[model samples]
Target: MQELSNRTSAFTDSVIRRMTRISDQYGAVNLSQGFPDFDPPKEILTRLAEVSMEGPHQYATTWGAQNFREALAHKQEHFSGMKINPNTEIVVTCGSTEAMMAAMMAITNPGDKVIIFSPFYENYGADTILSGAEPIYVPLIPPEFNFDANVLEAAFKQGAKALILCNPSNPCGKVFTRKELQIIADLAIKYDAYVITDEVYEHIVYEPYEHIYMATLPGMRERTITCSSLSKTYSITGWRLGYVIALERIIDRVKKVHDFLTVGAAAPLMEAAAVGLDFGDNYYKELQNHYTHMRNLFLKGLDDIGLKYITPQGAYYVMVDVSEFRCKNDIEFCEWLAKEVKVGAVPGSTFFKENVNHLIRLHFAKRDETLQLALDNLSEIHIKAKKR
Candidate 1:
C-alpha cells in the first residue's frame, strides 16, 4: 500500500486533549482543556431549543446566515468601533480553529513565512504547517510575557507574510497593551504584512486590562483578519460557532477556502447563536465579572498553598512555575500530576518552541465548586513531589 501524505508525519496528538483523557482515566479534576464546565447563557439555550423545533436545519448561505452575520457585525462594531459589512466581510466557520485555518490558506503561498509568538496556542503550529507556511518564532519572554521589538522586526525582516496575534494570549494569558499593539501595527505596515488575530478571549478580560482590537490601529483595518468564537465568550464550545472578520477582498478569498473546507457552519446553531450576538453590554459585563471571580478564587487557592504563578491580565489560564519540584520533563510531570495529584494540566513545553519545561498551564473556567475541588487537589503537589 502507498504511504499517506508526509505533511502530517510530524504531527502528534494535541497535548491538551491527551491530558484530558489522562485526567478522566485517573478521575482527576480536568483543567487541561480550556472549556467552561458551566452551562451557557439561558437566552442562548432557550433560542437553541426553539431553533431545534423550528426550521432552518438545511445549510444557510456558505458564508453565513444573513441574520447571524448582521448580528455579529453589530456586536463587533459596538465593541471595536469599526464598521463591518456583514455580507462582504464575514465568514462564519465551524469554530475559530477553522477560521484561523481558512485565513492562513487564503493569505499564504506554499513557501510564505508566518510569524508566531513562542508559548503560543499549539494549534497555530499545526495551522502554519497545513497551510504550507514556514513559521518564524518570536519569543514572548516569560514572567511578563513581553516581546522585544527588535526580535519581532527581525522576524518580519526575513519576509514574513503575516503574524498571528493572540490577544489575551493562550498558555500565559498576557493581554497586549495599547502601546505594544501600536508598535506591532507600525511594524506590520512597515513590513507589508497581514495580522491574523485570535481574539476568542476578548471579553474575558480582568479589571484594569482592556482588549484593544489590532484592526482598530492606524493602517490596519484592511490587513487585519480577526478570528473569534462564541465558545469562550458565550460558554458554547460544543456549538462550534466562530468567524473571520476582515476586508471584503480578504473575506472573498477566505470564503472560497472555507467553503471547500467545511461547506458551512451548522445552520440551526448559527441561527440560535444570533440571539447571543445581539446581547447588550450588560451581558458582557456580567461575563467579565463572573470570570474575574473565578480567577480570584483559583489564584487565592494557589497563594494559600504558597504556589508560584503568574497572574493573568485577561483570559482564563494561569501558568504555574513547577521548577521547585525539580522536574525536567513537563509532560511526565503533568501525567504524574493527573494520576497522583488528581489534577490535570498541559505541559508548557507543548506550547513553546524554546526548550521550556518548568511551567504548566491550568485554567479556571469551571464552576466554583469545581475550582475549589481542583484547588484542594493541587494543594497537595508539594507532598506528592516529596514522595516522588
Candidate 2:
C-alpha cells in the first residue's frame, strides 16, 4: 500500500495508550493513562442498569439526548456563569475526543494555521493534522508552564485561524490563570479567530486555585468552542460521554460534522451521566479533596526518592525532568522503567513539537496503595539506573 490516507502519516499510536499495554505486560503499577482505577460513582452504575432495560437503548437525537444536554447546560451555567441554550449550542458526542474532532472540522480549512501550546496533550497534534490544518506550536516554558503574550500575539499575526487552549492542561498539568486567559481572549478577538478549548479537568483543581472557563471571558463566549468530557469529572472514562458548547452558528456546523462522526453518544451512558452533571456542589468539592490528597501523597513519595518534578496545580499528571539522570532516549528509558522498575510512564517527547526530550510524563490517578507501589518501585531509579 502506497499510503492509506494523508492523516495516517501524521502521528504514530498514542503514547499514553502504549504505556497502558506496557504496564500490563510487566505487571507494573499503571499510573500512565489518566483514568481513575477505582469504580465510578455508584449512582451512575445503577442508573445505567435501569436505562439499559428501559428502552432509550436505541439511538439518541444525533446531537445528543435531550435530558443529557439539558443537564449539561445547567451544570455549565452553574460553573461558568454563562447561560447556554441546550437545544442550539450543545452537541453530545462519544467523548471530548469526538467533540474536538468535530470542532476542528467545523472551524478549520486546509492549510489553515492553528496555534497550540507545546507540551500539549498528544491528541491535539493528531486532531490538527487530520483536520488538514498546520499547527503553529508556541512553547510553554518549563517548570511553570506559561506563554509570553507577544509570542502568542505573533502566532495570530501570522494568519492563524484558531488557537487550541488546553486549560488545566494534560501531561504538564498547569491551569491557566484568569489573567492568562484574558490575554489569549484579547488576541483571539484582535485577530478574529476561534478559541478551541479542552477543559476536561475543570473540576480537578487544587483548593484556592480555580478553573476559569475560557468562554466566560468578555467577548470569548461567542468565539470560544469548549470541548470537555464526563470522563474526568465523573470518573467514567469508559463511558465516553463529552459535549461541546459553542455559539449557535458554530454549534450548527459542529453538529453536522458530529452527526456523521459518532452519530450520537451512547444513549444509556448519556442517561446515566446526567446524574453526574446534576450532582451537588459538595460532590465537586469532595472530588477536589480526593485529588488533592492523591497529589500530595504522590508528591511526597517522589520527594522522598529525590526526584525532580513539577508540582501539578490541576489535572492528575506531572512531567518529570529525566535529563539529570542521563536518560538519553525517553522511549528506551520508559521501556526499561516498565520492564525493570515495574512502573509505566509515557515518554514526554511524543507530546512536544519542540525537540527537547529530557523528560517523561506520569499520571497520579490510582488508589493510595497503587501510588505507594509505584513510588516504592521508583525509589530504585537512582540505584540500578545508569548515570550520565
The candidate that wins on lDDT is 1
Give the clash count for model 2: 0
* lDDT of each residue in 189-303, candidate 2, tens digit only: 9999999999999999986778999998889989999999999998999889998999899999999999888799998789888998889999998999999999999999988
* TM-scores of all candidate predictions against the true structure: 0.99, 0.98
Error of 1 at 288 (Å): 0.6
- Scored by lDDT, model 1 comes in at 0.95
The global Cα lDDT (0 to 1) of model 2 is 0.90
Q: Candidate 2 at 22: error in angstroms?
A: 1.3
